[model samples]
Target: MTLSSNVIKQCALLSSLALFSLSSAMADDHTNKPVVEQLVDTLSTIAGPHPGIRKNHAKGIVVSGEFIPSPDAATVTNAVHFESPATPVTVRFSNTTGIPDIADNNPSSFPKGIAIRFHLQEDTYTDIVSISVSRFPVATPEDFLGLLNAVATSGPDAATPKPITQFLASHPAAKTFVETPKPAPVSFATQPFYGVNAFKFTNKDGEVRYGRYQIIPVNGQEYLTDEQRAAAGKDYLFEELPRRLQQSQVEFALGLQIADKDDALNDPTVVWPETRQIIKLGTISLDTVDDNGKQFAKQTMFNPLALTDGIEASDDPILLARPSAYAISFGRRISGQ
Candidate 1:
């Protein structure tokens, strides 16, 4: 079944509260860090041409100057299946901060990332899962909104720091990431994609257990330093994604970890540690590349709420916020009523 609009708003509100609460408690901890330095390092490492908003650029991909869907999938670990959900997907490639026509490769903005996803799945997992390229994910949902608004309003001087700084001062949750998030990887092939949500692993008998999904990348991650990225140009992430596709097959193995249901629910901030073991489930391989157009390349909306059967969402606030945010942005783009 499709997600309801009411649910989406609630998720955003709850995430806002959670992140705000986290930030309020850390004033002393992050007071020493410079917000500008943090933003510089934080935004520069995003991977792809689009950062926060999915602007409907699903035309396809371009590799080595050829257009296609990124052809390096066959060798991707656990990438055993290939099927399109066929749900209409809109991909927008742009930045979380900066005006509509601004170049995302600017060192001052966040790097690119894809939001590819399909509509609601039949008997799909109830638990939602959304992950950012960085470890802390984001400190608050309002921060996300700020990102969108920043990009929407960016102009000469590109001084996005003002609004964000004001927001951090007003919202405690925004303070949590004062140390700077690690940033999204420059190449999706190298970074591990996480299900990032706690789930219940059920048995045929209806037994249940807590779990997490891990998309293990075949390569190691590489990030852009603020200085290096500034000199690279606005389309750096876009250039990198296609560059890797031309070299070889790109693959990621999907794995799951069964953790304690109680602990899993209580601690959304901690990773359940790989020593607990992540069971391999499947793989996703994009066998071609296409730089044809922004519609084909960017705006592909991927929501953790858009799931298949056999998995589920936890009570985690962050996981729940994605479906709502994704739905709002997606619904606005599609059914433009």
Candidate 2:
């Protein structure tokens, strides 16, 4: 019998909650180091050590743009990005893993990263960091570390069930992430990105709503077929994006998928149903790139938890862990480690 999407989400949520509780207890007993440090360590183990660079999604192209907010944007939040006029923006599109030159078409580089910096008034800024996947592979930082560790330990010569297989056998969400089909996009401009972690948005009246962000391509979604993927170059996305921009600006609509009363806010592994209301917050137009913008993208750290007002992060451990992890990366990069 085929199970419904809601049933699948509920089952995933319950499993994730149980795993999160158990992982927290184990973490409290086992390690004294901060979860962010552990997360970085595990990522390094999987991706190999790369000093002075981001632990993952190290290779990227930077661009400049403008965020044109919708009139109804203030209805969801009083955040400056929504209430203010069109703001300048900086964006980066990246591949997965610490290997900076990893092939874009490699299966390992499935979920591309999209990091945006909304330049608000008075030198203040808000950031949105998302990936191509709608839901995260694991719900908690502990499980995320475990997943990385599992992959690091697994190989053709590994004994018994193999580390990754054993790990996935117990974690249905992680298994789903591994099994999910991630086709290569024709270009970064054609891909849709999603913020897996839910955040609370508060309007001027102080009414709060939980939602996840989605960047829908204004050009519509398009993916390369297996044959086309095989024919693509290693750095196709990086090369194609700039070439495409030379012709015209690339655009995407910034949208927020508001959660229902029963939605699992803390479990990012549980994707909210499509039936949920989505509000178009703004349009992001990537027009051009200059030396300064490229340098800013290289130097600046985009932290999802870097909120202004009227917006707050959820209690998800993965969400909580991001800022510290990003700090570690930023420090290493700036200090020339």
Candidate 3:
């Protein structure tokens, strides 16, 4: 049965209410639960459950692509994909939030997601998971949990200076993150995605450096005007993707924004100066859309920590916690939760 967007939204509201009740009953025992479980539970309570859908970024489309490394890539990292002629990639573009049927124009969906998994030889692979925002809202898993809980409790009817408002007041970085302008993109092909977390790059010669990734579209950034956004269809972004791909391949230049000597390497909430050097690493060319994109997205988990010999994750707490949190969600998705 085909469900209308309104119906889906209403259903999500009901599911969220039910999950909220369940969560409240378990609230007293929350501290004893692992951080991953708490995160998943809070997300489910906030966005509601759609069986077999992801706990976060539930709306996504998978596409096939390849990475063509630049000669400059070898100067910083000896990762297998960077040294190879070409590496096959499975890419997923998604909206923010766990609501599977959120409208393309919804404010909650502004920070779009892009996950790329590089398929190396002999069953080895690495993934780059990024978002439209250049800096993250929080720096640690515990603080992130608090932020999520605040969001869950702050509804339209909540008191003045709601939970989220109070939380934001105390957290300056999160306030900045919220105030960051996230314009609605005309199409996924036109938006740039940022890797908020830093990674350690080690060359074959053993030189080590830290940097964050910036994936910019070759077509350049384009965003909907206020009038255009208001007049656009709820599924405009999703509908535009396949049609655009059919006409021509979408490409993005991948670069690393190198950190300075005194830069904060482990804090994703910290933003480096724009004047910092960016080394072109490669190009991502997505040619075909997966017919079963939704199913593929459901089955696959694009982890940020899935690294190789030359690339290692920094000491960022949020980056370190992603794999476990994603694993819990992946298990539930595959099991038809």
Candidate 4:
């Protein structure tokens, strides 16, 4: 680390310690934002520059498009595949060339989703899919933010800075994933995880709480082999999924694992263990029938923070950073602001 960076870390540590000491003595206030919320707030304070340009519609929706859910992108556990003639899925495979939300339609742009938008006028939740099964394995929002920035500026010769930054922020588990981005293909995917980053859940009783979601693949284990995507090339996932789905129905089920008050800092990349078997809530049906057709090939957006409750958000660091960054670029696209 640079001398300046080391000094910055020290100052941050002291400030956090002082704040925690003061806060601990105070009465526990449910009114205060949860730890996860605070993390999100912190990420906003340290936001970056992501200027997105306009783009064509995807499938029929104005939202960003899909990134092919290939093996390297498959979730690790709690994965299930389903089939239905009524709903066919189409995914767009693109290169996340620059940061999370560069020009949405940039040929090299890799960000899969725009910021989660709430029409407020409507009540609807969309698809259940992911590139990497586990949301960010990282812990801190700052680290995730750096990763996003790195992704925004990445290219073929780009260093492993994004993933490496994330590992540093979260430590332990993230380090392993970053060091060895073990590719577990959807063809061989079993339990594909979702970042389930974070969202608010309003129970039937009208209580507001937080939680994360996961997409578990139901089909037998089918992960991508190392030979699959040695490159994060364009349409990398696109070229493979068709052959797999053509032979069999490609699907995975959505499951929910609510976060308790004490369990809010949930990051998807780490294993959540069999004991926490997510409650099966829904199924993702991927058929050859894609309504999006050419449109699907045009757009892509896959932010884990985009969620609806029964499903909700958590105080996880990366989740906190995602919405704001996602929104800024998404707004840039629709409004051209």
Candidate 2 local lDDT, 104-176, one digit each (tens): 9999987999999888776667889999999899998778878887888897788979999999999999999
lDDT of 3 by residue, 125-241 (tens): 689999998999998877888899999999999998899999999999999999999889999999999999999999999999999999999889999998898888988988999
How many residue-pair clashes does candidate 3 contain? 0
Instruction: Specify the highest-lDDT model's number.
Output: 3
lDDT of 4 at 152: 43
Candidate 4: misplaced stretches above 4 Å?
Answer: 1-123, 126-137, 147-174, 184-191, 196-211, 227-236, 244-248, 258-271, 289-311, 331-337
Candidate 3 TM-score over all chains jointly: 0.91
Report every candidate's CA lDDT: 0.43, 0.82, 0.86, 0.40
Better of 1 and 2 by lDDT: 2
Per-residue lDDT of candidate 1, residues 65-116 (tens digit):
1112222222222111212222222222234432334444443344333333
In candidate 1, how many Å is residue 147 off?
9.9
Per-prediction TM-score to the true structure, in the order listed: 0.55, 0.90, 0.91, 0.51
Candidate 4: worst-modelled 10 consecutive residues by lDDT = 76-85
lDDT for predicted candidate 3 compared with the true structure: 0.86
Off by over 4 Å in 2: 1-31, 292-294
